[model samples]
Target: LIAYGWHTMVTGQNVVLYSRLHLVCSRPRVLRGILWMIIANWFISNVPTTVFVFGASSANPGPFNRPYYVWERLQLCLYFVQELIISGLYVYEVTGMLKPDFHATPPPQKERRGSVLSALGTGKRWKSRKVLRHLIYVNIFIVILDISLLIMEFIGYYEVQVLYKAFVYSTKLKLEFRILNQLTDIATSRMRSS
Candidate 1:
């Protein structure tokens, strides 16, 4: 159930990203892109923790059939690989954090110098109008990259949950069998000694 919830939550972030990316312009667009990056990172980081908490409950074994005991190990392996790729991409994205170039915008100016407020940075704090085009490009790239990452993350998350569930169940069965064997050994020894 938590797996399903995580799946839903990741998908929801994608929807929000898509909607906000379209209507926003300039600074707001950049803000939206940065927001997407943050959310994606948060969810990705939580994935390993989720796996630990739920064990392997997310894995579904209906597709792979053998002894039912052997189950499917490949799916779980794939989950780890996919997680690695997403984590790598996030590392690359974080490099942008130190990039002031991306954040630069046109500076706003006023013709009137008489206003007391004009002395403060707020009056001229904005980026110059000349660089608006570059800012637009930076924002657009952020939006596109964010959306792509989200799609990949959604796919990976589902796989992880399904594979985790199946693996946990198989492990539990093995543990139970071992416990029963120990009990049988003790019972047989008591009878023979008597």
Candidate 2:
């Protein structure tokens, strides 16, 4: 629960920073939609977990009852869905930014391939694509782990859920730190170059 709260706070911080630094408010509706989804998901996923974890419900007998277990799994699913939406939004934004302007001189034929390795070998645009790819991969990994955890819980492996949640959330936080750092570096370099 604490991990969820921390992740939510970090996400909220990122949203605020992007809005202020990039004028995201003036961007497409998708950006605003992503912002609201992140905020709403954070609240939706955190509130029940927080209540069960630290509120009077903790004292209830067999707090991990069938309904509680189902609710928890649903929350995890919702969390991953939000992650997917955020990642997709990011990819959309990055690709849009990287799109060649028709009025500008087109790149040579050799520079037009869309392969992942080719993108990585390129310059600033490549950096943005690489970071976005990393973000997608990380989110995919987390979704897989989350599904495994949910399965374990469903199959009466409740004993490991606490430890698993701890490990997963901490690892996710570290990944988020790396992602944020890379994004900041990319933005700073872009600003300087411009």
Say which candidate scores most in lDDT. Answer: 2
TM-score of model 2 (CA atoms): 0.63
Candidate 2 yields a Cα-based lDDT of 0.60
lDDT of 2 by residue, 1-194 (tens): 45466456546544543443243123666666666776787677766666655543466646545556666677767765666555555556554654532124435667667755444336655566677678668767866876776677667676687677667666766666676677678767766756
What local lDDT score does residue 33 receive in model 2, on the 0 to 100 scale?
68
Which window of 10 residues has the lowest lDDT sum in candidate 1?
64-73
- Residue-pair clashes per prediction, in order, are 19, 0
Cα lDDT of model 1 by residue, 1-194, tens digit:
75455445444443433333332223555556655654565465455435543554437534323322122223233333443343333323333322343454434555235545443223223322222333344434444443444444456554654554444334433433443343344335435735
Report, for every candidate in turn, its global Cα lDDT versus the true structure. 0.40, 0.60
Each model's TM-score?
A: 0.25, 0.63
Clashing pairs in 2: none
Error (Å) of candidate 2 at residue 51 is 4.2
Query: How many times do residue backbones clash in model 2?
Result: 0
User: How close to the true structure is residue 141 of candidate 2, measured as C-alpha lDDT?
Assistant: 84
- Report residue 74 deviation for candidate 2 (angstroms): 1.6
